[model samples]
Target: MNKPVILCVDDEVMILDCLKRQLKTEFRNTYVYELAENADEAMILIEELEKNKSEILVIISDWLMPGIKGDEFLIGVHQKFPDIIKILLTGQADEKAIRRANTQANMYCHLCKPWSATELIETIKSGLKTISKS
Candidate 1:
């Protein structure tokens, strides 16, 4: 079977880099990480992954971004691929975004900014475990 892929979206390069390193260290060769700065690029990557027969297993997106908000981005993904696990990370997520994510996207979880590497890894692992069973 194909190994699962992880799609991460963030406007900041540092967060994306940290996530890549941590996920690589924790999951090792089990995942292929794809990073994008905005929703449009993320969608393009999703299409490419789909063509490669490796749909993304999870998405970790920042709640506050330049263009589309994290909730909006996840909602878009959920519209096409409902099974993909969605996680939102932000320092200042508002109530509107959270409510929208809950009602529309069915967001799996939200992590505060400056999330510990260990916690991030554990969250991803737990999410993957759930995905594995289903």
Candidate 2:
């Protein structure tokens, strides 16, 4: 069986590397970590994973990207896969975008850029806790 996945999308290679390192430290071999450079790639990966009967437990997305903004991308993801937990990260957050993500995408949370590993892990844990309740 495939391990459930934690998907992360960001335009920056450094950020994607940091996220993989931080999440691997906490999750170890628990999840399959997939990274995409843009929303288009992420969407394709999502479809392929789903087609292969893999569970995508969460998605962490950067707010600013080349083609689609994080909020809009998450909204699209939610439309198709409402159960997947969505998280947004931004260096400079817009209230409207965050609010829209929260209301429209059912976002689990938004973290400011440069988040501590502990905080990021805790946020994902908290999001998973809600899934347990549901």
Candidate 3:
């Protein structure tokens, strides 16, 4: 069976790597980790993953990027796939962006750049609990 995916999008290579590392460390082989450097790539990756019958359970994205911003990207994703949990892990996002994400994208959580791994894992766990109950 194909494993459920956790996708992380960021413009910075290092940030993407770090997020992937942390997620892999925390979740172990529970999820298939995917990384993209921009919103466009992420959107395409999402489509491909879905086409391949892989379940994308979570998406963690950065706010500032080359093309689309995180809020806009997540909102688009939510419109198409409402069940995938969306999270913003950006230091650059302002209050307006965060509010927009919450209202439009149904974002599960927002964490700053220097995120605590424990908090991130806990947040994902809580979000997954709601999904499991439903």
Report the CA-based lDDT of candidate 1 relative to the real structure. 0.89
* Candidates 1 and 2, the one with greater TM-score: 2
Error in Å for residue 98 of model 1: 1.1
Residues 1-134, candidate 2, lDDT per residue (tens digit)? 99999999999999999999999999999999999999999999999999999999999999999999999999999999999999998886599999999999999999999888898999999988888899
Ten-residue stretch with the least lDDT total in model 3: 125-134
Expressed as tens digits, the lDDT of each residue in 20-127 for candidate 1 is 998888888878899999888898999989988996999999988888889999999999999998999888789889889988998888889889888887887888
Please give the TM-score that candidate 1 achieves against the real structure: 0.94
Best by TM-score: 3
Which pairs, if any, clash in model 1?
A: none
Candidate 1: C-alpha RMSD after superposition: 1.2
**Regarding TM-score, does 1 or 3 come out ahead?**
3
Predicted candidate 3 versus true structure: per-residue lDDT over 43-130, tens digit per residue: 9999999999999999999999998999999999999999999999999999999999999999999999799999989988898887
Q: Where is model 1 poorest over a 10-residue stretch in terms of lDDT?
A: 119-128
Residue-pair clashes, model 1: 0
Shift of residue 47 alpha carbon in model 1, Å:
1.0
**lDDT measured at residue 102 in model 1 versus the true structure, 0 to 100:** 81
